[model samples]
Target: MKPAVRTGNHYITGDVACAEGAIAAGCRFFGAYPITPATEVAEHMAERLPDVGGTFIQMEDEIAAMASILGAAWTGVKTMTATSGPGFSLMMENLGLGVCTETPCVIVNVQRTGPSTGLPTQTGQGDMMQARWGSHGDYELIAIAPSSPQDCFYHTILAFNLSEKYRVPVLVMADEIVGHMSEKVVIPDAREITLVSRPRPKGRKDRFRLYQPGPDGVAPMPAIGEGYNVHVTGLTHDERGYPVMTPEAQEEMMTRLKGKIRNNLDDIIRTEEYRMEDADIVIVSYGISVRTGLTAVDEARRLGYKVGLFRLITVWPFPEERIHAIAARVKGLITVEINLGQVHYEVERCAHGQAATYLVGDAGGKIIHPDKVVSLIQEVFQP
Candidate 1:
């Protein structure tokens, strides 16, 4: 069997790095259908998983791929899958199922430009909003954006840890640029890596309540064959995991589903600030756009504009409070993304008139240029 953690510096693509990250995080099952940009992730897993006594299956479709992982996750092992735009859409129903059942797993969406097969080989940050809201229901899940190959490696591990800890599916939102880009990634020793497993149910097996939350608003989980009477479904269920068709049951289920994430905002939300100690304008971005924002911030500084960059590492949960705080102090906020205005609207909504909000974005198919971002910075604030 191969080592779970390869434990060395190796030059690799972000897609391959992500596969390694999942393996290092003790992910034993990977079920996916190959798609452009994200194919390498599954390919790597297929070649490596069996060496570690893990399972890798190429499912018939994205829907089945997502369902396969959710089923595997319930078996008390870490599981994951990878896909791009259209496949992501195909998986939405099961994604909602994962949220409803509180299944712990990871889904990597290496995005390409799309409404429908727009650009299979290029990069786009167009799926940011979809990652948060594509699933139809009142639910909340963690979604993180990785900016580079190194980020992809570490962030995939982070995704697994957060998924297990929170008992909800976590997303690694990568664009084609980051997924295909090659760079140096350091995989830490197995002993040095921290892994989290879902909290197991304790006490009398006969009286177990599958959906009863602990003090932290998260329920302890048990595998199907652990001899616990576990009942799981997508319907509105009570603490016992039995379907309860009532307003109260729905409210109770929804509250717990959303509360776990909302109540722990401080832990779930993460952002990186660059040169914002004193600045009049702040550029807000995530994924590949952060790379553009970084360069633009430096150029804006050289041009004598007090500009900074606010990079969203955890894109969901939205980082509203931090962005609001920045908006209160800055004269304006510029959002750089590959979509016309998905996350840009969130930034604008958070600004709340405290500062003017602008968007430097494209329809897709390419990364936003640093020059465009710098120009927007200049337009938002004069010398």
Candidate 2:
């Protein structure tokens, strides 16, 4: 049977919509653990995976969950796992393992207030930086932020496609409020959804050159049972996938790992510009802050201020080139998020002194009111 994709519109939470999106993306394996504000994703997958001939296993812990998904992906199956702050942290070690082995997978982090279980049911964007740097080393990966139930449904598919396209783990950064908030989610028919498959290796096993990248830089992935001489290790390896510990070997291995994604920056970076054609200040934001960011832009316009919105749909890869060009044109750039300036630092670096940069941060319990965001605009733009 085809993946049990829920066709048409329905009232659902972001978590449920994400699970449905995964099914539509042709995910045939899921290794999950129950965590607050994110368990709904696993619960929905458990109910639906088997219906679509997919396997759903509830792991003992986040580490094992992360490991199980990576193992499943090696069998040429699309896989995913869902978790929150604490669990996301626990999976970091294995996350690196996935990256080093170039295992394609999707990891969803339904963020809740944290720094060690700060608040179980509250929302927060504290993990934004962690998502980029958490797993350690210098590997580049893709991560997307969804602001609503609809976006969670949409971007989860994009996350899977990108993971397969790049042969690395991709992240869906959702939050407590968005995850649990019920809203209208329009899931299209399975046939209408465009799914991308991982590139498959071809040629004789000895001549395959397992690590040899294709024209697009991503190497073709081969299944374990295939007759290919496949050997994958976390240590530095050559094109044949054999372990090579010398510094030269490490450089060659690391270069391909980072270069493949970095070389295709044009294809990886994605953003949204709202009413930004002519504006003096652009409010840069992603995730849940987007709700208030748009409100602030609207109110600022009402007050006769030249304000616009620059939303970061693909949170990682940072969209530096776009910001670099915009920074020169705008008088200033304001970054708003539910944490103390995590993405703010990225905006500031991209500004490069051409535009003044400001941060409108939240401590992460309740949503930041639009009034407060507009207050910052008035304070900054006013004489």
Candidate 3:
């Protein structure tokens, strides 16, 4: 198979492609427990890391898997973990820990069906909402959804880049279809990849405050043994890292943490628009559903429906402004997903009554077909 976009040699499964992407982006530590539809990612990392002087650990459970990655990140190592629905649920508590402490790492959720052990091998986008609000309290999260095997390679690298840039944990929310599917992925030469390294602490060691905010709202982080005597905690802390119980300190800390991502939304949010300029109806989708929606768009256009596709590459830090702009021009918005209406609410909220929002979804442990999506578009655009 020929490579879709030039990066390196082609032909790989999405999981192997993602593992290779992480290696290319400088990830040195992987902590994970094997889970179906996502196990290939861990297996590949274990095999690849040792050759490059990196470390890979298979933890006892998903909870341990999540926490171990955070510990590795504190040592200033680029770290990651892989899981499915059930395991993702287990990792939520520690995910909050990584966020509050501003730990930079990557968490890959190759989604499978269900609330609890629903379908171990079947694909579903049921965890879309969980990726944003799974952890407790208010915080910003970056989640990227890949539509194809090739994108899994590119987006995985981007996930690590974003994690390091903002000092926040990032999620690569893939699904079973893309994870197991084999396709050609072109990996770029080492020199061609634009890698983002975390900002390091400067100033005299004694004068340094680990939590001091920079102009961009992100604080420079120091590794555990960097001779900086840095202190880090999940609790709200003063610039020096001591626990600050005062309400003012708490407010300031939370504001900075959330503002870093919010203010940099332009760099953080990404999406793809297809045939949207003359589109009377737009099909909004992500992950595996996006592929189906693309086919639906082509078919609708052939039938003279004037339809288009909007594929979300970045799921979190929702593309509200872009969606609004597109919605203002389209007559209707159609959301397609494997799960029942998870992201549809977001489309509705962003569309804000500018156009009719419709959902074409299924919870039957498989993806919604493109033909079905085309049918929904026709029904909505009936004249």
Candidate 4:
């Protein structure tokens, strides 16, 4: 069998790096339908998984692809899938099934410009809100945005860890630019990497309740043939994992689903702050935009402007408190993204009029220029 951890430095695209990272993280099952930019991820997984004693399936479409991973996840193996915009939309129902059933898996949406196949070869960040709310209903999700090929390598592993820990699907939101761009990525020794598995039930198998929440608000998952009666469904089920058609059952199920993520905000949210010490204006961005935001912030600083970049590593379950705090102290907050205003609305809502918020964005298809970001910084510069 081929070694799962290919520990060394290699130059590769973000999609391939994501596959390598999943392999390193103990992900042994991948089900996906081929799509532009994101196809490289599935291609690499198809070639490498069998060599590592893992399974890779090219499902009929994104729906079956999403369903395959969730079913595979129940068998106690790490599972994942990859796709772009159109496939992502198709996966929403099953994605919600993954959520309602509390299935642990990673979904990598390597975004292309799109309202509907707007630009398959080009990059866009239009799916920011969709990643959070697309699945429907009231549920919290953990979405991480990777800024580079290296970020893709590291954060995909993080996505798996978080998914297993919380028993929810975690998203690695990458744009076409980051997904297709080649860069040097270092894969460390397997011993150096940390992996998380879902909590397992103990004691008598007959008495086990499948969805019973432990003190940590997460339930221990059992494999189907473990002699434990496993009943999984998308309906409102009690801790026994059987459907209960009542308002109270729905409330209880929803509480457990939402509480696990909402209660652990500090542990799940990650951001990188650049030059914020005494800065009066802040640039906020994630995924591919962070690269441009960093460049723009540096230029503004050289011109003697007090500016900084607040990079969102975890976009969903957004670091609202941190943004709100910064908004109060800064003269203005500028959000730079490829989308017109998905996350910008979140920032504005969090700012609460304490700071003026501006958006540096477009419909899709290209990365926002650093010069445009700098110009916005100049326009909003205070003294």
lDDT (Cα atoms) of all candidates against the true structure: 0.93, 0.91, 0.90, 0.93
| 3 against 4, candidate with superior TM-score | 4
TM-score of 1: 0.99
List model 3 lDDT by residue over 1-383, tens digit each: 22222456778888888888888888889998999999999999998888777899999999999999999999988999999999999999999999999999999999999978997779999999999999999999899999778898889889999999999999999999999999988777677788998889988998998888888888898988879987788888888888899999989888888999999999999999899878979999999999889899999988889888998999898999988988898899999988888889999999999998999998847888889988887676863
How would you encode candidate 1's per-residue C-alpha lDDT over 233-296 as one tens digit per residue?
Answer: 9998999999999999999899899999999999888899999899889999999899999999
What TM-score does each of the candidates earn? 0.99, 0.98, 0.97, 0.99
Better of 1 and 3 by TM-score: 1
lDDT of 2 at 10: 92
State the lDDT at 106 in candidate 2.
99
How many clashing pairs in candidate 4? Answer: 0
State the local distance difference test value for candidate 4.
0.93
Going through the candidates in the order shown, the clash numbers are 0, 0, 4, 0
Q: Residue-wise lDDT of candidate 4 within 1-383, one digit each (tens)?
A: 99999999999999999999999999999998999989999999999999999999999999999999999999999999999999999999999999999999999999988899887779999999999999879898899999999999899999999999999999999989999999999999899999888998899988999898898899999987888968899998999999999999999999889999999999999999999897899999999999899998889988888889999999999999999999999889999999989999999999999999999997899999999988877776754
CA error at residue 96 for candidate 3, angstroms: 0.3
Kindly report which residue pairs in candidate 3 clash with one another. 7-187, 7-188, 8-186, 8-187
RMSD of each: 0.8, 1.1, 2.8, 0.8
Which segments of model 3 are wrong by more than 4 Å? 1-7
